[model samples]
Target: MKARIYVTLKEGVLDPAGKAVVGGVHALGYSEVSEVRIGKFFEMELKDSSDGERIREMCGQLLANPVIEDFRIELGNS
Candidate 1:
């Protein structure tokens, strides 16, 4: 089984890397681009796809910052 995780900053949190990318995009003549938010994507292989609780624990403990960032998990057959 395969598990995919997406981690992103909360709505009010500031993202410096995203801001830098937006600046670069504008400089390249894409003035219509307004904002960009950066995030993390993780893929893992799991022995038991039904183990959602353990995956959530892993995310809360290490994968994402619970205070400033939110994460979503997607599980699918490999």
Candidate 2:
């Protein structure tokens, strides 16, 4: 099986990198972009152990920092 993990900053957390991107976009004349939020995407292959519950646990334990970020897992066919 395959798993895709997305990790992002929490709502109240400050994202300097995202802010920088937004500024850069604006500077490049893309004014339509009102905001930007940067995050991480990880793709991995797993064996039979790749269950939803286990993937969620992995996100909470290692893929993300629960205190300042949130994560979502997408499962894919083997």
- Tell me the whole-model lDDT of each prediction, alpha carbons only: 0.93, 0.88
Q: RMSD per prediction, one decimal? A: 1.2, 1.3
Q: Please, what are the lDDT tens digits per residue for candidate 2 over residues 1-78?
A: 899889999998988988999999999999999888999999988895657897789889998999999988889874
Where model 2 places Cα greater than 4 Å from the true spot, the runs are none
Q: After aligning candidate 2 to the native by TM-score, how far in Å is the CA of 53 from where it should be?
A: 1.4
Encode model 1's per-residue lDDT on 1-78: one tens digit a residue: 888999999999999999999999999999998999999999989897368888889998999999999999998886
Worst 10 residues of 2 by lDDT: 47-56
Model 2 — TM-score against the truth?
Answer: 0.90
Clashing pairs in 1: none
